[model samples]
Target: MKALAALALFLLALHPLSSSAQVAPAYHARAEQLLPLLGKDGGEKDFFSDLFLTAVPVNQWRALTADLRRQYGEPQSLGSVRQNGPTAGQVEVRYRRATVGFTLVIAPEAPNRVIGLQIVGAKQADDSLIKVIDDFEALPGQTAFAIARLTDGGPQWIATRAPDRQMATGSSFKLYVLAELARAVEAGERRWSDVIPLSHKSFSGRLLAYPDRAPMTLHSLATTMIAESDNSAADTLLLALGRENVDATLSRAGHAEADAALPLLTTAEAFALKMPANASLRQSYARASIAQRRAMLRDHAARLDAKAVDIGTVAETPASIDSAEWFASPKDEVALLDWLRRHGGEALPIMAVNPGIAPADAARWKYLGYKGGSEPGVMAMNFLAQAKDGSWYAVTGSWNNPAARLDEPRFVALMTRALNLLAETSR
Candidate 1:
């Protein structure tokens, strides 16, 4: 008899007894009733919690407690009840600071507690936290594209198209050109201040129209080309950098698909590639001479497998065919940004293209860099911003919606929203 009694006591102690155990019958019954509501994997706990905590009125806590006790015996403890704010849901429970608590949210027709009890804080039942939950639940399912929230490094939204989809780049390809130029200057192969004369042949349309035709320094031309989207400066820099050097630099940068032998293309040639058959090729060539037009068309024909004459008067340079399809992924773009951040030392001229930064924020953000590209129906912007917190993020967004031809404005809006979202979440 003594041995049996000792064995029973040992078994009882192994399971232990607590306030929660006192209500074991009711809890188990409630758990069974609520199990179905909890869903197959029991993953809807948080969702149900948010619904219940937000749905119930704070003033009814005492009355609800009384009803609960009358129907299912007294609860072990009501825990802590705290108010967060206007936006977030309020909580009322009997709990101590630092103590774990379980929450069970019950809904009508679901005669069981939908959520299993879980640990919570007395102080965390605040309005702000509730608002966060509400906001998350309220997000729309469809968006323009997959966009990364700059603040928290989280992908905040995904657009209809897969985020990984690649598109033709258009003017954004200029970044590659600028990158090559920067690499040359860094390698001591070229100097920032080195001036290379512009040939009359290189002057057509805009370049031909510029008053300052004297030998322009490489630094001036490079900056103007990238920052202003200056086609003439881009062509000149391309010639200066040489096709071989640019191709080698691109290869080194892991742009294996890029052709080094391709000629520097002009905006006119790029536009002409998409021109309709009915359009006048020579008239569309703008100021390009017959020889320049022939050369441009020849290059375009070679790259796109179409007759150069068909492409018309656009002075087709090597830069013309450098579309977005040069094959870059978001991850690749981010990696390139990281490399530039590390090795693009002392080349402030090339790195100064942020279009949307304010002076004050620029000072606070410390390093604000941006690259944007736009063509008829394509728009893209790549950003590298280092915040005051010593953390940095690299973001790139490319939109290719033929129906929506507003590339620059759209890109600016998307980039701004992403940056702002990042700043908000970082805190």
Candidate 2:
């Protein structure tokens, strides 16, 4: 499962630039026009150009605005607008729940139609650690998080919520695979640049469409596995590194539920078992002992391939998340990060490829290595972050709901707020 928490990129419909002095007011006017339509209906066709509408259909536009309304409430005011050029500028829109900053671009002509709009950042009026905890509790389902501030002696627990309670962690479990790969490299068993044939395939990745058995480097697989949460890339690496070896990472990294995480399933196996067609197989695997489950994976390996997975059935709703998906506590995740920080040399850059937060928030850290994961009803985000003062911290969190889908962006916004608060402390 790919981490579905990326910041939404409003279409950047660029047009020819104009240097007219009238650009600023027209751009501001268009922004003002768009603001009032949020949380309402039927303004997308009138305000958006054919190009914009084509890229972002009317239904998507409606859903985006409605989501804004649901999360931040109606737009209360627009702050000072800073013009980037004749057709571009930025503004802060204050909503009932939060203030959101947006970069706006427009056509260089009369009416100055909106050509692009991107959410750059957001902030809340009563931002605090306590408030962050409160907001986490306010979310619809089970939530766990841990923040540890590092010092010379070691890590000090700064804040936490159910730190020891295990929850489903979508693709975030790939961090352990990364740790094991790094360990092998350090032991001289393999090199990051070592080449191998791409031998596994799964959905939610670019590799699934590539020619089978195409040659690729270990580093390339790790990059896509972490940076994009590529399922195929992950499965290929897991099999190459050896499942038992990767399983050892859990215990070595202080995973609280190592036994529960035993016989870790590849993306393909997970998808295959979760499909409605494999109910009996899923039940048998769930009830089996660790050794038995391992045997089951071996004996049933052929039946648990790409052909067995039904994407439609799996997407219908959350299926066996508690029983089938990766399990980790917030504290366990922090411990894993601590191990990686001390041991992960080459893997650090691969993790840093995706910051997992807004550019403004990510800039607060000297280095931010992030990996997150998500599915229909599960979401998790973890970071091994280094501050400007050479301090290291691990921030990890998860949200899970077995009965319904999750609001990924809403959870992301809350986590981003927590990170921003940490940035203030580091400075």
Candidate 3:
């Protein structure tokens, strides 16, 4: 989803900027007012809204703010500020207890407002896949990287830094729901035009935020789920298609360990699984009888509100990352993309709406489909592209670090390099 992880951005809000370059006065004043509140929570009346406030709701604001306090301790000061774009400047933030540094983006247009944020890393972004991954793996945390191409039959191994292993795939798992829905439509059991009332609601999607209770077509829901990684849309589709059915479909599409996502987690269920209380509950459920698990999950699901979720708990600890979340291998990822290319293929087109690859690179292909997922310690990107000769191929990779936040820009830079190489070589 394009939506920022609330805790990631919230933590950036607390940093003190330190820079060798000149900084705008407007940026300083805005940082002073918002930084203190972001450092430790409590002061709410001081928020100023221009673009960000209008885009994110107040409830999300509070949930994220509270989550950061538990993770980062408290903010100390703004360290340095450097202007990047006419409308963007990066600021460094210092936290009281944590050693990690943050890069805060201040909108040049609204110099008084924060626009983007990221965790800085020792290894800088590089175009070379080898160097990039070398830096990534050499960094203090764990990371797995892989790439594959879709053959006429299935994925062909290209390059990999790790063995064929399943890693946590954030919203990329929604592909399972989309695949099942498309299959049902092709079988005449359902229609793409079938209109269903928005059956669920949650954050990480624009559809849930729609003003009117307009019934959207199944096609529309599927589109937004992949295009925007809409949690509500995915949950709705999961309910309609039957979670078990999607789970089976994902396996048939080549997911190695079907049970890894067993009882097929709804976003709410998955998010709750990250919470200390619910994470324990999930473990108990996993050990319980199959007959009792679904009921137990449903009973707990009834009690959850988005606010009840820590939002940061998914990346809070190694124990949590290992115990509660979705998992997929890059090999399995390419296999699914290839399946969509040949069987009930409406999905790839819907995914094409978001080109997760470079534009110059995209131009080399007849079509491209991209889906990405992320939480605190996790990030994933999977692409399905068609060469001009109508040959179908998929390029996919994932990165994880349970101990700390990811260097999002650098990771993306690394993946983009992979995509660029495929774009150039495929032609």
Candidate 4:
């Protein structure tokens, strides 16, 4: 069982067209025709082709307009059309507050009505890297980001804010698990298709309801763990790989404060230990030395099972996030990604299975690999991208607030803007 994490909106798509048909200049006018319908009541039937209407019904199209209005206010003007092919063009619609760009593909024959439409990107007025940073700072809690260009020597910083400061990573820590898995595969110690039994379960993920000890392939576990943030899949993989090996990955991948993450706790343990009923145990575990804590985990392993987790207690304000949750810095994440990109070639496609951003935004990159994590007061997003110019870059950000919950969408939007800016800058 796998439950998908909502990364970003990927709009509709229709049948593929031939590569030879050149986009006619008239497609620009056709692209402009869509601007007026943003807040309009009717007329979708007149503008869109029958095939387009079949794919995206009138009601769904209207609902899309309503959502756009709510987020960016009413549409005002249209930007220039950039041709993609003989039948397709990209156009930007200027809204009351934000600028939205979408792709329009018209039917190949005469009466070239719209056959495909997909929203590709959106940005606030005067949106820039600095503006994005300012928005991150305006958030109520700690927010940090790092955008770096990877080189043969190492990561060369492009932009950074507290890049080395450790913060709760939530599920982003799975990347390390992935790194260690790749190492084992390359070392001939394990194979991706090797089958392993589900050794642990957690409160989150659809895998929680599955029969315990279900047999699954290593590749499937890693895929669901990274794409769906499936806790059980992650724990099963971690346990199978050996925790000490993953801990070794921490140092090998250039983690600055690896000790803070000593004795990596499985998702089940993290949840169970945060339960209100286990406060005394949690306190004791927090105070113990690294060696002592390892012994404690061994002795109390059963008590930290998913059955012991009280969702109500841990789902409220952050529960010992500083001391309990996985911690990583922006720089550490960049290093981890860089290592994966260079050595984990087999895992690259697994990472790209979910781009974690709008399909249009993701298309700008030659290659984009993503894994993000969020829980209550913590949100983290990390990306390993190859720009169209053949340059490799790493971008990562995290937000944490112990006293209150963080806004995931806001953080996502800001990070999206940063990614879009990076794409534009590199080009």
Summed backbone clashes in each candidate are 37, 0, 13, 3
lDDT of 1 by residue, 1-427 (tens): 1211001111111112233333434343443333332222333333343434444333332343343334234233343433221111212333222121233322222222333232221122232323332332233321123333333343333222334444445555566677787787788887778888763222223455666556888777767766676667766666568745654555565443333213334444454444444244424343455355546566544443223325333323222222312335454455555556655664443656644433322343556676666654555667666766766666676655444344243245335545544554443
Q: What tens digits encode model 2's per-residue C-alpha lDDT throughout 334-370?
A: 9989989988999999999999987657878999999
Model 4 lowest lDDT segment of ten: 1-10
Q: Give candidate 1 regions above 4 Å deviation.
A: 1-163, 200-208, 211-213, 256-268, 277-327, 357-364, 425-427
Q: Regarding TM-score, does 2 or 3 come out ahead?
A: 2
lDDT of 3 by residue, 1-427 (tens): 2212221333333323344334467666655655676655454433443454555555556665465555456656676666553324555555554333345455444334565445441112223556656765775555666666667655666667663677887888888788888788878888988998777666677876775446989999999999889988888889878877887788788877766556567887777776777756868766766456678777876645555776665544443555566778877787777777777567778988887643434556799888888877788888887877776777777777777777665567567656665666677
Residue 389 of model 1, lDDT score: 75
> How do all the candidates rank in terms of TM-score, highest first?
2, 4, 3, 1
Which segments of model 3 are wrong by more than 4 Å? 1-136, 211-213, 286-292, 304-319
Residue 83 CA displacement from its true place in model 3, Å = 28
Instruction: Pick the TM-score winner.
Output: 2
| Model 4: lDDT to the true structure | 0.84
lDDT of 4 by residue, 1-427 (tens): 0100112343335666655554485587677788888768698888888877777789877877887787788999998788868787678888898888877788766667788776777877877888888888899989889999999999999888889889899999899999999999999999999999987887678888888899999999999999888999999988889988998998898898877877788888898888878889889988888788889889998898777677788887888887788999999999999999898967899999888887878889999999998888899999999999999999999999998887776788788889999999998
Sorted on lDDT, highest at the top, how do the candidates line up? 2, 4, 3, 1
The global C-alpha lDDT for each of the candidates, from Candidate 1 onward, is 0.45, 0.85, 0.66, 0.84
